[model samples]
Target: MHTLDQLKQYEKEFIEKGYFVLDLNNMEYVKEASDLLQKHLQKITNNSEITLYNYHAFFEDNDKHYEMQFQMLQFFREQQFAQNIIQSNIDVYQFLLGPDLEIQTEPYLRITRPHKPKDNIGYHRDTFYGTGPGEISSVIPFINLSEKSTLSVVPKSHIIPDRFFKLNQVVNTEVPKDSKRHKMGFLYAPKVMDPEIRNDVIPIPLKRGQALVFMLSIIHGSEENNTDYPRWSTDIRVRNSLTSLNEAMKAGYYKPLKDSATTQTFERLSQ
Candidate 1:
C-alpha cells in the first residue's frame, strides 16, 4: 500500500531528473520472470540451471541468434510474460503516469553480447517511436550491470525542447525502422544535445531485480558490454490508460495494465 504523498515524491524526482531507479527485490514478478527465462533457456540450451548472468554461454550463436531471439521475444507475447512486464513495476507506473495504465504488448527483451560496439545505442527519445508525452519507459536487467555493461541516460533531458526529437525523427524515421538503427538517441549525442549534455549523462549500474523508470521522452542510450557475460535486460513502455487508442497502443499493440475505480465503474456502466 503506497500513499499519494509518496507518489508525489516520485513524481517530483522524475520531473526534475527525468528518471529514477528502484530496488525490486521484493517484487513477486522478478523471481517469476527470472524463472520463466530459465525455463525457456533450458529448452534451448538443455541446461536446466541457466541464469541470466550466464546468458552468453547458452545462446549467442551467430547462426541461431536470430531464431533464438525470435522465439524468446515471441514468449513475451504470452500472458504470464506480459503480466510480469507491467505488473512487476505497477507502482512505478502509477507514480510516473497515473493510477490507470496501458503497457506495450510488444515489450522487448535484449541481450547485448560482449565487445559489441554497435550494441551501444544512440541518445534519443521514445516520442520518435510513437510514444506520447503521457508515456513512461521501464527497464529491468536480469543480471548485474554497470558502466559499459548497462544503460546510460541524460538526466532532466526530458525538459529540453522538441527540436531534438524532430531531428531524431528525420534520422530515425517516425515509422518503424530496423530495431538495430533505433537507439539513435544514444548514438548521436552531439546532434541531440549540447557539448555540456555529456555532463548530464550518467551510466546506471543495475543489479538483478532492480528497475529503472523514466519518462518516455528522456534522452537515453547504452555503452558497450565489456563484461565477460552478456547483459540481459527487458524494456517496456506504458501510457495513461486514457490515452487515445492509437494503432501503436490499441487492442493488439498494448494490454490493459491497471484501472482506477472511476475508470472501472465507467467501463462497467458503458458496457
Candidate 2:
C-alpha cells in the first residue's frame, strides 16, 4: 500500500501523464483468479495440462475460440472475480477514485495469444463510448508482459484537444457471426485513423502483481502479441460514486464498490 504522501504524488503524475503504475503487493487474489481460469480452461479443452499461456493452441477454429472467450467472460461474472479484485485492492482504489467508488460490473478479460493480430484492440478513448471523464481505467496483468504483448499508450494524449485528431469508428469484421461481439454490431471503437499518431504511442511493460491505471480519455491500445508467450490481463473501469455518469454507464454496467459513511447512514435512515 502506498502512503498518503506517495499517493498524492501518484495522483499528480496520473493527472500529468494520463497514467500511473500501481504495485498491488497482494498476489494471492490474482493467483486464485488465475487458478480459477486455468481450471475452467482445462474443463473446456478437456485437457488437464491446459494453461492460460498455451490454451490458444487447443483451439483450431476461430468460432470455438470466440465461444470459449464468451464462456470465460460468463464465468468471470458468475464468480464475481472483478469484485474480488477490486476488494483486494480497496485501499488503492479508494486513494485513486475516492472513498465512494463504483466499479465496472463485468471486467474485460483480454487474452492476446502470441502472433494473434485479430485479438489486438485499436487505439481509442473510453469517452467515445459514453464513459464520463471522471472514470478511470485499470489493467491488471495475470502474467509478466513484455513490450511486444503489453498495452500501448500515448502519454498526455488525454489532455490533447479533440480537434487535433479525428476519430473513425472501426469494426472488426473478423468477429465470428455467431459470437456475442458480432451481435453487438460493427461499432467497436472510435479509432484515430492517422498513422502519424503511432510515433507518440509506447508500449508499457508490466510485471505480475502490478496494475496500470489511466485516465479514460487516454489514447491507448495494444498491438499484436509477437512474444512467444500469451498475454492474459483484465481491464476494468472505476469512478467516484459522486461523479456524474451517463445513462448508458449507469444501466447495470456499474455497481457500487465502496460507500461513504454519510451514504451508509442515509441509506439506513431511508430504509
Clashing residue pairs in candidate 1 (N, C-alpha, C atoms within 3 angstroms): 122-183, 122-185, 122-186, 122-187, 123-185, 123-186, 123-187, 124-185
Candidate 2, residues 137-227, lDDT tens digits: the string is: 8898888898888999999998987668866656555655445754322234335457777788999999877888899888888758889
- The runs of at least 3 residues in candidate 2 whose Cα sits more than 4 Å from the true structure, single-residue gaps closed, are 171-179, 182-189
lDDT, candidates in the order shown: 0.68, 0.78
Tens digits of per-residue lDDT, candidate 1, 113-145, equal 787654445456665556666777778877678
Report the lDDT of model 1 for residue 196: 53
TM-scores, all candidates, are 0.79, 0.91
- Looking at model 2, the pairs that clash are none
Candidate 2 whole-model C-alpha lDDT, 0 to 1: 0.78
